[model samples]
Target: MTSTDSRTKEDVSSRTKKVPPPMYKVILHNDDYTTMEFVVEILVNVFGKSLEKATQMMLNIHNKGKEICGIYPRQIAETKVETVHNLASNKGFPLKSTMEKE
Candidate 1:
């Protein structure tokens, strides 16, 4: 390619900016019907949290009645919350989860 064309292409590439991924917070709401054991299991299995971390989070939810489970990119956070909700519902529990912008 010509030097002029190459320089023009490089300039355009340098000027173009990539849009950053949106941030989201995944939250878990406490419920009487869902046992703490189930919450811990979900945290461990779905969120890849360690057993101790999952227990701590479960306790937080129990005492605080709600807690932010984790932060992630928008789509991923939403998906995680949705997966947890569905799993809880399928297991006949009233557990609820949601995601919002960080």
Candidate 2:
């Protein structure tokens, strides 16, 4: 094979590197109007936390004012935050969620 053809093959392999998606943190913000039980429910339903773990998360929010609920890729984290906000608004609670780069 010609030198140019060999160079082309080598270049193709060098370009094949895969980049991993950046991660993000989904966070919950506490509010007095939102009940502790509701926060636990959100953790269980939205983040797929177990009941026991959900309860612990709820307690954290209660005492900490805010806490990281889950870590996900950027798109997933954004979708999760939007879902939480919509669910909270529909239930008439001032529950807040946000995502930050991890």
Candidate 3:
């Protein structure tokens, strides 16, 4: 093939190659009224953290006001944030969650 044709093929292949999706951090926000036990439960049930790890994360949220629960693709992070809000609200707690690009 001509040099020009080869260069075009290379460009096309590069364009077609899959690149990894951008990631986001799911963060939990602590509130005065949200019990520490509930925070731990959310971490364990929602994020799949072990009880020990969940307890550690809960403490971090308690002390720091917010902490990242996990990193995931943008959509998953957003879904997780929404789920946390829904569950917390349903239970009459003011727990909050948010996502940030990573």
lDDT of 3 at 88: 94
Superposition error at 24 for model 3 (Å)? 0.8
Candidate 1 lDDT for residue 98 = 87
Question: If both were scored by TM-score, which would come out higher, candidate 1 or candidate 2?
Answer: 2
Q: How many angstroms is residue 25 displaced in model 2 relative to the true structure, after the best TM-score fit?
A: 0.2
Models 1 onward score TM values of 0.82, 0.86, 0.88
What local lDDT does model 1 show for residue 43?
93
How much lDDT does candidate 3 score? 0.94
- Candidate 3, residues 1-102, lDDT tens digits: the string is 577656777798998999999999999998999999999999999999999999999999999999999999988998899999999999999999999999
lDDT of 1 by residue, 58-88 (tens): 9999999898888999889978988998999
Which run of 10 residues does model 1 get worst, by summed lDDT? 1-10
Cα deviation of 70 in candidate 2 (Å)?
0.8
Best by lDDT: 3
- Runs in model 2 lying further than 4 Å from the true structure: 1-14
How many pairs of residues in model 2 come into backbone collision? 0
Name every residue pair that clashes in candidate 1.
none
lDDT of 2 by residue, 1-102 (tens): 577556776687778967889999999998989988889989999999999999998898889889999999998999999999899999999999999998
Which candidate tops TM-score?
3
Question: Cα lDDT of all candidates, in order?
Answer: 0.91, 0.92, 0.94
